[model samples]
Target: MSPRFEPITGRYLNLTLLGRPHRLYIEEAGQGIPLLCLHTAGSDGRQYRGLLNDKRITDNYRVIVFDMPWHGKSSPPEGYQNEEYKLTSRGYIQMILEIAGALELDKPVVMGCSIGGRIVLYLAHQHAKRFRAIIGLESAAHVAPYYDVEWLHRPDVHGGEVSAGVVSGLIAPTAPDNHRWETLWHYLQSGPGIFKGDLHFYKVDGDIRGKIDEIDGRASNLYLLTGEYDYSCTSEGTLDIAKRTGAEAQIMKGLGHFPMSEDPQKFISYLLPVLEKIRGAA
Candidate 1:
């Protein structure tokens, strides 16, 4: 199929949520049912650039992506730079709710990766009626044996370089050279300690094992997709979450932590089937 040749539209808007004003960078393409994408921690909406440009998806859906506060072109509220930016479940949910309201999205399908993935479960559990569905990429009920946070804070080492070293092993060994490097490139450009701060939420505060049963798949169409090469949040762990939550789970082969960026074409191949299933259910 010929790729969607239409240009993506982008804008910066200030959203006041949770008692703060956040200037967010948002992008969108196409028109139809809304597809809201959340990026992996320490990264930005750039991960979904391929999806935004894909005609097959855009033809049927309006794909929206945004850089979270302090993550990309988005800027944190005043005085946020002075304090540690830890992502709380409540705060994260509020941001999504406010964004959805502002965009006037009608029960958008929410998809996220990593910390983003972990939060989608919370979204489903806390506000099932707000979303048409929730898609989790590299998500699990719990993540253990957290990575070294000190290394991410060391003065001698560049945080980006250290972050790259930490994540390099998690990408699929078979990933294409360009895609692999592109995934690493995002890490290399991330703000200092941002990855570690995000992990504080992903591995610590985001554990949903105790409440996984509260998520109703029939209400929100919860789905989990994990990469075969992801040891951080392994397929086994994701399957366990699915079993507990009664959500459908799939293991994508030849993919790693950053599926969309590591291999967009292959990731799309996997996503299309899930999208079809969701549409049928809707």
Candidate 2:
């Protein structure tokens, strides 16, 4: 069977950055403070479809979601030197800065999942004034664990095997079927090259746990959101990040890594108050 497309649409933004016509698939809607939404490494930014389209969040903020180069419908750059640029967090961050400037958004709030979560944390650490607030769902303090060679050297997989791997050892297998199956399926086949590059990027140039204090001092707001059952980022790990950085942290009860996809209504409930706090600060 063919893969399912997310039931969301906004704009197909194309802009020349670094002398290339990068295809940027963005979901921009509502009218308020700019909120840029990013997805995990293996999946396209469309992972944010549910949240970006929801009335509760969008009604209060001008939410924007976009796929990075080589993921989803966003075609990669021409003459792309995969080895030189693939999978580096720096390159992704550069694209993000350029994308934000192109959208005419100024220091918007950033929200991400998994790797997306990591990216926002990196930005908050390195470039705090660029964003109004930072929200990470199942975010991490470090990168080496997930991007190890053992996790990437595996052979290509079909949906069943991918689903099994995602539910095993990390998220609760008893989670909702459609949410579980779809989220796994989408990430499994997006692009192995891009995924592999991402792993390489983190392994070589990733370490933020030691610098949490530096990140906290610069950002206006930092929030950590994760599911109680999210073994991918253990409760201990998230708590350690929160404690060191002195940021408000939340662990959603009975949920797992994919809390936004698993239970968006509950996800939004946790998200709104934090966003309100940021807005009030502004």
Q: List the global CA lDDT of all models.
A: 0.86, 0.71
> Backbone clash tally for model 1?
0
With candidate 2 superimposed using the best TM-score fit, by how many Å does residue 281's alpha carbon deviate from the native? 2.4
lDDT, residue 98, candidate 2: 90
Candidate 1 clashes between residue pairs 3 or more apart in a chain or in different chains: none
lDDT of 1 at 159: 89
- Candidate 1, residue 258: CA error in Å? 0.7
lDDT score, residue 277, model 1? 81
Please, what are the lDDT tens digits per residue for candidate 1 over residues 3-115? 97557998998778787877899999988879999998888888888898888888878999998887878877799768987887777888888999989899999999988
Top candidate on TM-score is 1
